[model samples]
Every structure is written in structure tokens, then in C-alpha cells.
Target chain A: MKYCENCRVSVRTGRETCPLCQAPLKGESEHLFPEIKSVYNQFILFFKILLTATISGAIASVAINLMLPESGLWCHYVVLGVICFWILLITAIRRRTSIPRGIVNQVFWICVFSGIWDALTAWHSWSIDFVIPCTCMIAILALGVLGKVLHLPPSDYLGCILADAVFGIVPLIFYLTGVSQFVYLSLSCVAVSIIALVTIFTFHGKQIRSDLARRFHV
Target chain B: MNQIRTKWNKLDNAAKLFPTASTRAETHVFRFSCELTEPIEPERLQAALDETARCFPTFGYVLRRGVFWYYLEESRLHPEVMPEQRPLCARLYRPRAKTLLYAVSYYGCTINLEVYHVLTDGTGAMHFLRTLVMKYLARAYDIPEENLGYETAHTSMADDSFRRYSHRAPIKRTERPNAYQLRGAKLSESRTGLIRGTMSSRALLDAAHEKKVTLTAYLSACIIAAIGEDMPLRARKKPVVLDIPVNLRNYFASDSVRNFFTPIYVSYDFSRRDGTLDDILAVVTETFARELDRDKLAEHFCAFLALEENPIARITPLHLKDIVMRTVYHNTIKGYSATLSNIGIVRMPAAFAPYIRSFHVCNATNKLQACVCSFGDRLSISVTSCFTDTAVQRRLFRRLRELDSDLVIETNLLDDDA
Candidate 1:
């Protein structure tokens, strides 16, 4: 299968040009991952890379903490894990391109998002504790760009952001009040992230249902 | 929502395009009844009507850009006008007849004449009109349908529609296609105008056949000549293009529910230009060759879409779009000395043969419109223009009668004095 760049039409396998527009393919089908596939493909990739990167970061931080007991560099490792997580998410949605194109697209969105986070923290006079959930909140909001390219409606993506803010941050609030151990805080954040992300993906699936029904009279 | 929109996104961008300008302000209904040499069978007649509709599916096409040649939807069956409010929009209203009335009802007048402008020219419609009547006759009369087919034989190639019909001079261009200047060109001082004329679709066709020319080419020459004689200032431009409507259904290999047409810019300039009838026929034939080409029509349709996107009012600046639209409305209304739509001759059943002795053609809500139709032996040419000059109309009829010698023209003038 291939995708028409101008109109975003899908061409069947081995087709020379898009039947509707008659434009030739520019080698989009040869790649392992098409820019637009099932939504599950995107979610799965992010989930896998996110697990890989974040778990390694956590293990490295634990090792550093045991080696230099007074250094307490685990905070830096967690923050670095989140930033890499952000970069990985943006690249998944952008067109399959050369390393430079991928880097450019990824970097542009990352800076824009990071800039908004910096401004919001400065305005609210938020502490380091707030930054973790705030970074997640903004990334959730940025999912709209993906939804539009995929022609999915905004409702579900917006719902995901709301869920992340409520579910991801409320426990942080609970932890800030000195209610739980550090292990529970980390576990709750991971659990909340899973639930919010799952809900967001499902909401988009509903939008797809209605859009498909309208087109086919199904 | 995501499931459906995802698939819809895959349809051609051309499928999503729609018309500008008072889109569907008038309805797009068309009807034709036929009388047979034998008594009509209701079922057979209905079957024939279906075939007639199948041929001219352009009623299914939609307008994009300035052309009428695009349809992208899976289903072309637009929702029928709700019976309740249908009366408010059109003055000519009728109660929904019985279920069997579908045959006749489907063939009633097409309301969306604005889209008609870009489709096959009136002469082309005349061919469709004739075929429709024949289809009905073949089914009702038990005659073979295949034998009633038509051949598009073009002979006289290049001639102006007006000159052979009327001895009018060409108008000179006072300005170029720069800023639209027709906004200030409204007629302030009233001139005496009296329009009286009649045309038989059969007679026009016969006249073109006699001269070996297409009906559109024949009438177009007369129209150009009339402009040359009537408004010499506006006739200076040579090789003028007419916005001849081409029915997309007959031409394009796509669904016919939307707008589908292209303009034929028939050139009026003649190499051996003479006022003789032979000279006129020569020019008309060649001019038609220059204007009518299927590929050019398709390209024109694309250009129209690129120039203007879908014109839904919510997202677009309505006030600005209207202002721009007004310029097009004024210039075409003014630029062309006049538009002549020969809704050529038709044959209807003897039942309807009584109520509709003669039918006329009028498009858009604009009073400046002019259309002529012929049924059987009866022909009527009608002009609906603002009450500016009553005498120009009188001159029009006078010249029309002088050319044909068998012209029977009548009119209903909407002037303030009356």
C-alpha cells in the first residue's frame, strides 16, 4: 500500500499511482512503517520504546545512587528519561524521512513544547515536583497534531490530555502531602500513565467508527 | 467518528469540491413527455425514461471552481427537497403526484440552470432533449430504441451566431481584463425597449442542417451579429468566448450527480469575413472547432476548482465572497452582449401536449437572462432584463423576424411603467 502526499489517499499494493488523483508514488510503501497505519501501531511503538528507555534510566539511576550514596543523582536520570521519551513520541507520527528530516521535525516540536513548559512553570512559580506531571500534561496536549494528520477528530485526544492531567497529577498531589513511600509514587505514576493513555487511544477509536459509518452508509 | 473519517479522507480531493455562485438557488429538475404513433404502455414508458436519465447523469454532478465536471461521492442521490418548504423557494409549485409519476416527474424542468451555463451549450442540451423525447416515444410506441439514436454531424465550422442572423457590427474593447469596471456600468437612464420574438427549435435545427452547421453554431452567429448591430461598443473584441454549457454526464467518465460543464470560446474573427450567408456559415463552423474539445473542457474544470475552494459559508468570509461573486455576476451579465440558450425542439405526449402548448427557458434569478425553446412546431424566445430600454427588445424581435421570416416571438416585460 502507498499514500498520496497531496490528498492522503491510500493506494493498494503494487499500484502505480493513486486511482483518484493519478499521482505517482515516491517510494513510501517500501518502508517498514507507513506514516499512517492503525492507531494501535503508534501506541504500541511508543509503549515499547518508552518501556525500554525509562526502565534503563531507572536502573542506571539506582546503580549511581548505590555507588555514590550522597550524590542522589536519580532525579536527573528520571528527568533525562522523560525528555528522551518526548523525542521518541514526536518522531513516530512525522513522515518517514532521512535522519536529518526526522531530527528536524522531532527537534522543532520538542523545543515548542519545552518552551511552553518553561513559560508555564515560571508563571505559576511551580517547583521541581510540578515539572514531571506538567511535562506529561503538555505532551498529552500535543497529540492533537497527530490526530489531525490521521484525520481523527479532536474529542478523544483532548479527553486523553484531561485524563492524564487528572489521573497523572492527583497522585503527585497525594505524594506531595507526604502520604506515600517513593516506590508507591513511582508505581502510581506508571499506573496512571497507562490508564490515561489507554483511555485516550480508545476515544480516538470511537471517532474513527462514526467517520467510517458516515462515508460507507454502514 | 475516527473509523468513518479515516476512510473518507481517502476519497479524491476533487470529490469534495462544490460550486460557487447562488449554488442550487433554482432547483435541478427536468421533465420531457413523448407522444407515440401508438398508444403508450405505462410500464414500458417508465423504463425508457430511466434510460434517458442514465444518459444525462450530469444532474448528479456538482460544480467546482467555475466548471461543472466533478463528482466524488459514493451515492449521487441527494435528499429530495422536503415537500413542506419546497413551495417557498420556487414559484412554479405542484403537488407530488402518484408513485407512477416518477417517470414524468424525473423529466420536469431542471432548476439548477446556473450550473447549466458551463455544461454543454444549449444546442447540446437540445440533442439530449431530443433523445429524451425519442426514448419515451420508442417505449410507449413499441418502437426500437436503438434505431432512434443520433449522430453529431458538424459541417459549417467557423461563423459568428449574430452576423448571419442579424447585420450587427462588432463592439470594440474600451478596457482590458484588469479591475472589474462593470460595477459602475449599471444603466441609469432608461432607453425605449420592446422585445417581441419567437423561435421553433425544429426550425433552428432545420436551418442549421440546411446550412450544414450545428444548431449552436447557427444561433451563436446570430447572437454575435445581434450584439454587433445592437451594441457596437461591446462587440469590438474578436473571437469572443461564449460560456456554453456542456453536460458533464455525456462527457466525463465519472458520476453525474454534480456540476459538469466547460465554456466554448467560439472565435468570431473570419479570414474571409463577408456579410454573405455563406461567409457566416464558414466562420461559425471553424469557430465551433476552435471552441469544442473534450480535453480542454476537463482542464477548464480543474482550473475552476484551483481558483476557488469549496464555498461553505461558515468557514468562508461570506461578505467578501459575496462582493467577489457580485463582480462575476455583473461582468458576465454585461460583458456578453447577451446569452442565447436554444433549448431545441422536443416531442411530448399528447396528454401534456394540451396544457403545455409552448415552454420557455429562463435561468438564474437575474432579469437580464434570455432563453429560447421550441416544442413541436411552436417556438418562443423570451428575454428577462431590468427595465432599462424597451425599444432594444422591439429591435431584437424585428431583426429576428427579418432573418427567419417564420419567427413567432412573444414576451412578458416586467417594466415599472407597465
Candidate 2:
């Protein structure tokens, strides 16, 4: 009912100007499409503030270390620590949709970072002896419990459990190579891994095989 | 261990590129909507959608990532009918999530069906929207249900027609020069801007008959002329190419509701010839004659299928294949200036036609795209573009206005100075 003299076409919108030529329309109008509001993320400001605060903290630590040389080059560690924090935060945020995948990812990253941190501090081997084995064992148990409680499909959590079991076997290599000074935790981790693998293979063999076949199809 | 195994399907040959190349800016989601004379009743629409979903079981599948290729796995997610709240053609497939690839929403009198390209193409989506409208009308008005004949069998509806029609032949590759590209500031948040013009189909068909060309060819020529008017003198060396997608079901026997279309390029150099509507139409008509041949189109599609069938390409890991496919998609798009898809006529039963106003089709695109679909005498041509500049749209509509003075336009854009 609204006609634009410039474009010579009738428009069915409630706007004053023509959509094509921006000329004033000449009649009454009716709505054809609903007006959609722009999407705004409120957490954007929170993330911006967090990023600024971390960068300033790293800078301030470096400045303080330079002023006091006796601090013995500790500022580089602060910078690396900030970078490590971001890596972990990003990984968690990216995998937040899938709980099983997130747990598996967190276990891998936490063990790797703890090993590096322990090496930097000293050759205590606490990361290999305690952190790696304990994290792997806890992840395997948590996945099993959650799968049962949540009633997730066998295809969903079975693969994560298998992955964690494989990770659980890593401490065996550490125990054999003498990288782990205390042997009890690593041996227990190995025992738990073998038991979990046996249980899954005994019961959910078909599900795992189909899942693996589809995933690794090439 | 009493679990029923979920069925999964390999991505069709044309579907492989969409999962890799689709971005937030270009979601590769297309929409088909039916506007009834009466305001949509949500409960009846929901009931209708449930029945339609039961008919097309493939629409219930979700996109999943595999090591070698992305596949569609059957899921139990039920689609609900809600008021339209998101921007037009918003992103439907998110990475690492389990969700259906299509959505149904309503606004005022219109029932909108938005589908990701990986699920099906325009023809399939049109069939779905028609069925939903019919079912809703049948329930609401107490009209006897009439069968809108389509392949309702599960096996045939889910068939992979690309693999079925492709005969193993030597692949032919032709080098194409890059076409002219549109440049302008894009809409914020990567939203698509749609300007649809509805007019009498009989008038346009008469004009095409007078010109001795098909309606699609005539419209392509008009679009080429419009783009040519805006081209700078320096960019005249690059030809303006229009990529037209041909529905393979027309040339071959198929009952699939999945993707089975291939694009054929029609490029016209304004510098080489006088830039007029007639000149452009002559070029487009000739190109259509050569490209629309059965053997030529078969060769064209088979060449593409041969790449997917290659031993090395089949064995390559999906992550690496994603990188290569994404690169190829970007490069291939650069060879075309724009896309014009004519979904042809949409038919509904006579009993339901009294409740329907018209049907429209459009898609999200990084560049400009025009989608045409007709219902009754109403022909809806929806032009969608990411760029803020509307000169090409302005010229295209002005040209169309000359053919019919009863043109009616509608847009989703807001007034800036208001």
C-alpha cells in the first residue's frame, strides 16, 4: 500500500523511507517481518576486565622485580604463569558443552602442566608419582559414575573412559623407568586401569567397537 | 546391553564442503516460508510439524564429526514451534554440539522453515514447508487430508543420489579466471539483509516469452546488467559470473530429500560486448543451452564425484581434508561474482490454496544471492546480501518494476535515520 516514487515499487513495511532507494513512501503500511533485536553478550565486559587485570598484574610484577634485583629473575615465571592460566581457561570454555570431553581434556592438560611445573621447581617427581596417576584414576572413576547416573548413551562416555584408561597406563612407564620414586601410587593406577579396561571390554564390547569404527573410518 | 543401535549416514558429495567452509558470516542456512491469510496458531502448527517430521525422518538427523568425514546420525531431539526470535537465517549448526540441523518458527501469518544446507537443498525444504502448511490447514479447518505425493519411503528418501548417478570417469578440470567481487561494509554481527519483491508471475513469464528465453535466463540477465551498472571502469576486465544451481532430480531419476544439486557458472564480460539487457540475455541464453545439456551436466557432476572417489582423497584424515576443502571452497567462490537460484514453482492442493497468500525463499550469503520461488500467480524474488550497500538491489528492482507496476517489496532492514 506504500509506494515509493523513486523506485516505483510498493513496500509492505512500516518504515518511512523505501528500503531500496530511501525515498519517502506515499501511503499506509503493514508489517511483513518482525523486528529482531541485536544480540549482545553481557559476559564480554567481564572477560575484558579480567584480561586487563591479568596483563597489569604481570607488568607490575616485572617492574617490581627490576627495581629489586635481589628478587632473582622471578618475573618471567609470572608471565609464563599468566599464559598457562589463559590456556587452561580457554580449553575449559571451549569444551564446556560436553562434560565427558571436558573432563578428559582437563585431565590431560593438568597432568602435562603439573609435570612441567614440578620439573621447573626441582626434580621432586611429585607430578609423575602423585599428580599424573591420581588424576588419571579419578577421571576414569568419575566418567563411569557420571555415565551411570546421567544415563548417557554408551557411545557418549565409553570412549572417554577408554581414553582415560589409556592415560592411566602412562604411570606404568614412569614406574618402570624409575621416573616415579614412590611405586605404590603408580602400581595402583596401573591395576585400576587394567581392571577398567577389562570391565568395559567384557560388557560394552559392541558399543565401543562400533564407536571406534565410525570415528576412525578412513 | 539391550541398546538399539543408532543409524548414521555419510555426508553426500555436495554436503562435504558445507561443514568445513561455513562460517558465522555465511551460515549456509536457507529459509522457505509460507504466509497464510490467517494468523498462525502455534499449537496447530506444532501438531503439523510433528506429523511432517514423522514423514521425513531424515530431517531428524544431526550433524556429527568423524575422523574421516562429517556424518549425519539419527537423534531424538524434538523440534518445537516458537515465535521467530533470531535474526534471519541465523547459524543452525554449531561445532561440537548435538542439535537438529533445521528449525521451524512462526511470525504473524508466516511459517518459516530454516534448514542448514548440509541437511537438504531448496527443493527439499520447499517440499517440507508445503507439507507443514497442508497439515496445519487440514487440522485447523477440518478439511479432509489430501496426499501431496512425495517419496515417503525411508529408504528412497534417504538415498545418496550423487553416488548413484556418478559413473567412474576421468576427471576434467578447467581453469577459470577470478570474477569481479563486490566490496562494501558488511552488516554488523554478520546478519543477512533480505529485500523481497513480489509481483505477478504471469507478467514476468510473458516478458520472458517475448524475449524468447526462459524466466530464469531473463532474470539472470537482468541481474548481470544491474551489477554491470555499478562496476568501476578499472574492474571491467574481470567478467561478472553468476553461479546457477541446477536440481539434478530434473535431469535424473531421484526421490531423495537430501542435497542433489550442482552449480553451473554463467559468466559475461561487459568489456567484450556492449553492456545491455539484450546483449546479456543473448550470452546467458547461449550459456544455458550449452551447460544445461544432459551429458555435459553429467560430466560436470561426475568430475566432482571423481575427486571424492579418489583413493588418496578417500583415505586422507578429516582434519587435513577440512583444510584442503575450505581452501578449495574459498577459491571456487572467487570464480563467481554472485549466485542466483530459481527454486521453480511450488504447488499446493486446491483446498489449502484458499488459506495461503504466497511463499518466499532466501538464504544467508557472504556475497549477494537471489532466490526465486512462485506460488499461484505470486512470484517472490528475495535478494539477500551481507554488504551494506544497496545499489545493486536498487537497480535490480527498478529494472523489475519496468516489467510490472504492481511490484510489492518487503525488507527486514531498519531505518537508520528514524
Candidate 3:
């Protein structure tokens, strides 16, 4: 091992200077462990470049729109769209540890954003009719399939699916209140949610109750 | 998803602040490492950890946030032993999770036990580490499980001694201006640079005897003098305070494996007196004598408990409480320059001593900290600091080297100049 005359300590690794005093080390040193690399680090440069480009593009578009009087305030849509996209992307990356939870989060956010975008354009009811119900239906199907493919226990995906099912059932209110211009997708989503809930109750009733108790236990 | 109710207990008085104060930069986790004569067997160590985890039920729980406060609930999730990797004493307890609060990992011959401060204090953690080493050695060598003399009953070991000893008295609170803070560039990637020195306990004890003061007091004085040397001229008006955590087990008879200690501040002002080792030692010894009283220490902790009992604090939601407690932690921690905790001597049976080399204890901090514990004749003083500069640590260790020229040191910091 290398020794530092100044710090009077033996350096275990091959670093040329003392860790404390920064004095030059003498003699050979040893390796402690293999170098570590984080998975996210490989894409860091790419992410940085992408972030710079997106930010610059947004700024340039807004600047050009301001410079030209005929362009109108359409750049606001681009800014808000970019912000919402990044928010959803970051959330998905953070929740990537659990696939079921990430799927549920994505389904919820995508439906909400599409609804907001549709409302911003006009009250076309596409958000409630197609986007909301379709997102919920796809989420239910994806969760059911992923549970089997990933070999997840009922405790892992039951709560997430239950949440999505409850959200899916909300559009039935739109149908009953005559807020939805189209009824086929909303009715289909409600049917799928009821079926999913009944299946979970029949198969994993005890697990759901126990999971709730553990989560809410004070 | 079994319907079994998990066992949990309230966070002790000293422990309540740590969970909120903890962040990725400065986690309130400390590590206890034991180097053996040979490399550890992965399978045997895993079996030993499972056996030891069952023995200490409080160590098996995880931290959870409730409506009003944060509590510990039993977790059926078994914490598997892995190789050490992350920066020293990184955050172990993330909120809203059901993982074990303590982790066990091995690197070469070292068996490291890192625990969140909310789970236990140094004394409590020492007991757990001792038991874990005993179990590992017994299994490794096929020795019969013998009474290592460190084992305590789970019921009393998990007792909240601070609550039991709290007395309802009008508390007096003394406020001091913030001490001179250590300013330096932090280490890269938030890593703590750990440098440890192992020397003869008798030699260091004799040096303390020559000073006519206790070992802890002598070391505290040395630390104060070290910081005093580096303080700017304008900053000398504020005292250089050393925060020392006193183990309450020495005064009160409680076998709590949870937190049960209080910190006493020892301030030595260089502006008033000449900054010498003698001057620092005198001030430290006087402060220790004045503050170590049983009733005085009780009142100090009871004052802390008073805040926890306030109706407003009680009614505050955990989210709001986290913010308030975190602010309080930041402001209160600034009151001290550094912390020095001496766990004192670690004694083991003769049968197990031969297999063990030594034991070390150190904590993570944004500032400097020295954790001292001895095994056999070796006094292991591990200095863990977050700063890139080593002026304070150099002075502290060099002063120690003057006492014994045969001091041997080991460290985990990689050089930047390399």
C-alpha cells in the first residue's frame, strides 16, 4: 500500500496523493473495488443536448412570434405542451421502478392532458368520449397482461388496477348527466371497470383488504 | 398481504428530529464496521443476519409517516445483505416505504452495519453490531452459540427511556449565538472522507492522565483547539463549540436498543483566553462537570419533550411538521461547530476476540465529526468529514500522533491531485 509521510496514514488505493493532506504518496497501492457506473449516466449527455435544443426552440418560436405581428400568440400552446410533456416524462422515469404503478400514472396523466388540450381547442367532448375511456380501457388491459407477464403478486398490481378501475367508472357520470356527446366508449369503459372490480373481489378480496389496512395503519 | 398487524413504537425524543433533518446530502446514518481475520462467507453471513434480525424486533421495522407524526411499523420485508457501494452513510430511510431501517453489507473482510439514527443511538447500535458479529463468527467457525454477555431482552431493550425519565418541571432554555461554522469546498458526489487512526488505548489514556483530565474531555479540547486554529480573526468572537453526545445509559439504568442519549455543548471562546490546549482543556472539563448532572440532563431532555407535547405541535399534520422540524434542525445544528461521540471500550469474550481485528464507528455529516470506540488495546478514532479540505482533521490527528508516534491510519478518500 502507498503511504503518505504527511498524513502518516497508509493509502489503500492507487491515488497518488493523500486523501486528507493532499501530500504525494510513495510506493504502490491497491484497488478497493471495481468502478461503478450508473445506468442513467450513459444518457446524461444526450438528455442535456435534448434539453438545450427543446428550450432554445421554445424560446426562438416565442421570440419570432413576438417579432412578427401576424403570427398571433400560438407559441403559448408550444410552451405549455412542452412543460406538460416533460412533467409526464419525468414522472414516468421516477416511477419506472414499479411497472404497474408507472402504467397507472401514465394512464391518468395522458387522459388528463388530452382532456385539457381538447378543452383548450373547443368543447368537442373527444377528451371525455374517446381519450378518457380509451386510456382507462387500455390501462386495465395493460395491467392485467403485465401482471401475468411480469409474474407480479396480487399485492403489487391490485391497488393500481383498483385505482384505474375507479377512475374509469367516473365517465359513467358524464354519460348519465348527458355531458358526453358519444356514449359507446364511456359505456364500454364502465363495463370493463365493473368486470375488473368484480374479478378482483372474487379472486383477491383478502389481499386487497389487508393491503389497505397496512397502507392506512396509523 | 397477510392480515397480521405489524408491531411499531414511537420515535424517542432525540430520534424525532433526525427523520426530518435527513436529506440526500447529510443523512443521519452512522456505520459500525468490524474487520475479521478472514473474508466473510456470503451464505453464512446471510443466515447470521436473519437470526440476529429476529432477535432485535425493533431493528426489523421501517419508518412510516402518520397523520400527526412519524412512527415505526414492523416490516415483514427481509433486508438482504449486499456489498457496500453508495457513499458512506447515505440516506437509508425514505418516507412512505416499507424497507428495513438498517442495512448489512460486506466488503472484503469488513462487515458493515449502517443504521438510520431514528432506529437507535450509538450505544444501541453497538449492541446490535456486537450480536451480529457474534452470530457470524459462531456460524463461520461452527462454535456453539454461547452467551456473549451483550444480549438483552427485547421488551426492555426497546424501552423509551427518555420518556420514562421525563419529569414535569418548568424548563429553562438557554440560547447561544451560532458558533463559527467550518467553511470549505465539499467532497465530490457528496461522499464523506473517512480517515481513521488506530493507536494503543493505554498510551492515549496515559496522555489524558498527564493532562489530569478524562480521555473524552482531553480529546474534546484537542478538537476545540484544532478548530480554533483555523477560525478567522473576525469569527473568534463567537466561541468554538464542540457538541458531545453523552450516553444516558451510564447515568440511568436502561437497556434501550432505541435512542436514549442527549447532547451537551462545550464552548471555549478564544477571544477571552489564549488559544492553547491547556485553555481548551480547562474550559471543556468545566463545562462537562457543570452539565453532566442527572437532574440537569433530565431537564434538558424534558425541555425537548415539552415541544413534542405542545398542543399546537401535536395537532400539526406530519407534512407541516416535517417542514417546521427540518427548519428547527437546520437552525439548531448550526449552534455547534462539530460533534464528538466516544462510545468508549467495546468488550467481547476471549473466545471471539481472536477472530476480530477492531471495531470502528463514524457518522455522516455536512460538517466534521469524530466517532471514537476502542476494541482490545486499539483505540479507533474515525474522523468523517464532508469537506474537501483537511486542515481540521490534519491538526486533530497530528496532535494525536504527538501522543503516540506509532499511530497507524487508514482511509477511504481518493486524492484529487492524483
Which has the greatest DockQ? 2
Q: Which scores better on lDDT, 2 or 3?
A: 2
Q: Judged by DockQ relative to the true structure, which candidate is superior, 1 or 3? A: 3
Query: How far in Å is the alpha carbon of B197 misplaced in model 3?
Result: 1.1
Candidate 3 C-alpha error for residue A74, in Å:
2.3
Model 2's CAPRI class? medium
**In model 3, what is chain B's TM-score?**
0.97
Instruction: Give the range where candidate 1 chain B is weakest over 10 consecutive residues by summed lDDT.
Output: B93-102
lDDT of 3 at B225: 89
lDDT (Cα, tens digit) per residue for candidate 2, span A174-208: 98888889999999999999999999988998878
Q: How many clashes show up per model?
A: 98, 0, 0
| Model 2 pairs in collision | none
lDDT of each: 0.41, 0.91, 0.84
Query: Could you tell me how far off, in angstroms, the CA of residue A196 lies in candidate 1 after the best superposition?
Result: 14
Better of 1 and 3 by TM-score: 3
Q: Model 2, stretches more than 4 Å misplaced? A: none
Superposed Cα deviation of residue A209, candidate 1 (Å): 5.8
- Runs with alpha carbons beyond 4 Å of true place in candidate 1: A1-218, B1-18, B21-198, B232-240, B248-257, B269-280, B293-352, B365-372, B380-387, B390-394, B403-413
The digit string of per-residue lDDT tens for model 3 on B1-418 reads 4443336677788888988898877899999999898988888889999998888889987786666777777766796888877667877877555568899988888899999999999988888888889999998887766675654788998899999999776545667789989987887767777877888899889999998999999889988988899788999898888899999988888888899899999988889999889888888889999999998888888999888888788788888998999988888888999999999999887888999999999999888899999999999999988887888878888888888877766777765511
